[model samples]
Target chain A: MLETLPLSLDAVRDVAKECFDDGWRLVTMSANQIDDAHFDVIYHYDKDLTMKHYRLTVPKETVVPSISPVYFAALLVENEIRDQFGICFSDIVLDFGGALYLEEEVRAMPFCKVSVAQKQS
Target chain B: MARTILPFGPQHPVLPEPLHLKLTIENETVVEALPTLGYVHRGLEKLCEIRDFNQMIQIVERVCGICSCLHALCYCEGVEQIMGVEVPRRAKYLRTIWGELHRMHSHLLWLGLFADAFGFESLFMQFWRIRERIMDIMEATCGNRVVVSVNVIGGVRRDLSPEQCQWIEEQLAISEKELKQLSDTILSDYTVKKRTVGVGVLTKEQAYQLGAAGPTLRGSGWAQDVRQTGYAAFGELGFEPIVEYGCDSYARSAVRFRETLQSIDLVRLAIARMPAGETAADVAGAMEDDTPKPVSAGERRDIMQAYNRDKRHRFVTAPPPNLDLPAGHVAAKVKGKPDGEAVTRVEQPRGELLYYIKGNGSKNMERVRIRTPTFANIPPLLAMLPGCELADVPVIVLSIDPCISCTER
Candidate 1:
């Protein structure tokens, strides 16, 4: 079962840090394009076979704080979200500068609905 | 001393799939390795926006050819959970049987490839020869060797008869005997030990911090496996997670080898305790009399011809109306369309595969997020590569059994 806790961007770092301190494993991070302006970023944590999800809603241009400082594995998922959705994370330990998955020739943020809409227009 | 840059594959003979790694080497030791992917990216998650939940199973199965069954199983489970449909008991047991078979085949394939990576050509042949028998069983039972599309939203799409089950038992016994002999050599062989022992070591703490999964994590002494969570019929079959504490390339390979044998035993147990009943649930509000009628041979041939003529087009659309589906194929039917989100996690052969599906009370899903095992395992692979010598790169990479198709999907 998955439990979603909606938290402000400010609370994300604290919640993530607490989860890390409590020995929760960071499973993976997922980003959904809720709209043209807002995106939902979910951090999935697993402990003792139970899954807890922290959902943070941010605008397109917001630079979310990196959780890699807490869980080192978050670097990969954060970089992947940066590459796919064009969501930037501040102070990533190993920043690929948005070149982790996609090549430069491909349009930025291919998974973003806003980009698709813009392309259509 | 100057650092030399070595680019390892978007295409390399050692790699079965395309993955690019830029290794910065100084005096034959890798200082750092940077990975870049997307060579085989097909934008499959994006396709979910157009295809309905029912049609998305075919696409999900293509996420990784090696662990195709688990992909479909996870996706179907998520959708079924969303619709609150309880799969039939018999179907659940059958899914366990087939899932174990797929795991065995996949591990054997990985063992064969790993053997070849270290130039054990004869061992490679033996492992692959055993794998072919498993593939034959899959083809005979599910009709497709690689992407066995036997999972529907309500339950599985196929059943095993008693005679077929007996044949499977006989084949597994023979393969198990052969694997026992192979494992003896793999574990004790001097050359294999020299190459693998004390090489590319990942301690338990590092593995956890790096988020390694499957055998990679188990090799470092972690007994974490999603199968223990009791999805499908694993809860009934008494599954156990295999682990090793060597924390080296050898330990990773040994974990897979033992897991393959364990899967064979699980299949045997599943067949023995097989439940008797219908193989699929007539989902809520579904037509009770809308049973699928078998297509004629001529219609089957025509459909096959069309499928071959334009395979890419079929990737984007639903299966043809008059296609000859295998027996026990059930069209997913539900009381209402999926309106909320659900997350499903399954133990793929490589590691944990997670799926997040959200629907907006329509035929088409709003978002489908797949966090495949290889995608999560990449950071760990990169973390292990930096301290190793150039010659050990391929061995360490193959030790993770990286599935690039799954990663790029």
Candidate 2:
């Protein structure tokens, strides 16, 4: 049977806190936008030996907090979402500015093309 | 000491593709290095939105010339998860056999190039020559030197005949002997050791923290490998990740050299345990009894309209009888849908490559993103290079086997 570890909405920060304070090495954080209300955040953590995958979901505007200080990799992933999609991090300060993929003239922030007028513009 | 920034590539003798990295050097030591990417951006993720799942199989194979099997396997595993299709054991073994062969060739090919970079022409030729032998075997089986488009949605595209199977065993046996000797030579060679030892060390803590998988993390005393996850026939045969602990350039080289032996062993094990049955998975033909019916008429008409409105890629009927797909997501999230999304990780020759597929529920996918191993490994390179001398950069980079094309793809 397929297994999954479900966490409550309020437990998001605590989950990151346990992993960050523990010996688990924070590997990655992939925030997948399911829809306007559903956003799945897949937290990838590993130690010297084993790796763990933790998934948490929140509403579109719901800020579940950032694991930046706990796991540095999460910071980059969060920034990628900000740059690619327009998902705002509550207080995380990540320096991800620069032309990583798209050109300068074609909208600086994420979700630029997602808008119809901007896409046609 | 004075510091200066020297640009290394996008165009350099050591690197093949366009990977421009500027290194800040103080005397002979590099203080800081900044790497800029995306010169070879093909927007592959965007391309997938247009191509259907079946055609995307062929396109994903082109993601990287080497270790294409892993990409296809990851894609298949993702698709299989969505479609809820279980590949037969025979096909799993075939996946293992070809996957290991690809690993052996990729490592050896990287080894040859590394030797050439160090001006060791003879060693370079020796390794490349052995790699070519394996490449020839791969060509005979998969009909391609680099990108072998063998993977399909349900299972494999080509089934190996008895003669072809026997040929693979024979080729691996010879390659095994040559690789063993090469490993010995590489380990003991005074110059190879002198150049590689104590250069570019990624500590155990550093490796773990940075999320370096496969040989990179393994070289740093961590034996973690995704193969143990048993994606294919890996579970059938006892497959352990080849690991080393020294955590330096020599340790990295030794780890790869040892892995070559491991890959050959795996291929041998796979061939010996190979079962005789239909290697082909039926694919589209298997849909009749599949839990989810192929795509439904109503859904197809709606999705077709969505595709037409996009003015990009749309699914077309193959003719004869057009099957309807069941409502809700038919396959696993990896195969993608118009509504769901998936992130699949596969252990490539270098390390772990992650594929994130987001579906919008239409016939065509919405967005397909990839986070390659090389992109992840580059940060560690920043950490690894600072302590090492300028001369060792080429070998260190080569040891990681940075396929800039794979990263940019």
CAPRI quality level assigned to candidate 2 from its DockQ score: acceptable
Q: Tell me how each candidate scores on DockQ against the true complex.
A: 0.57, 0.29
lDDT of 1 by residue, A27-84 (tens): 8999998888999999988876679898899987788999988888898788878887
Scored against the true structure, residue B395 in model 1 reaches a CA lDDT of 93
Q: Candidate 2, residues B246-356: lDDT per residue as tens digits?
A: 898778778788888888888888888988765545432113221323644675466543334556666686432222222232221223333455556667878777766
lDDT of 1 at B245: 97
**TM-score of the second chain, cand. 1:** 0.89
Residue A97 C-alpha lDDT in model 2: 44
User: Clashes in each model (backbone N, CA, C under 3 Å)?
Assistant: 0, 18
Clashing pairs in 1: none
lDDT of 1 by residue, B62-154 (tens): 989989999999988888877778998888988888888999999999999998898998999999999998998898788799999999878
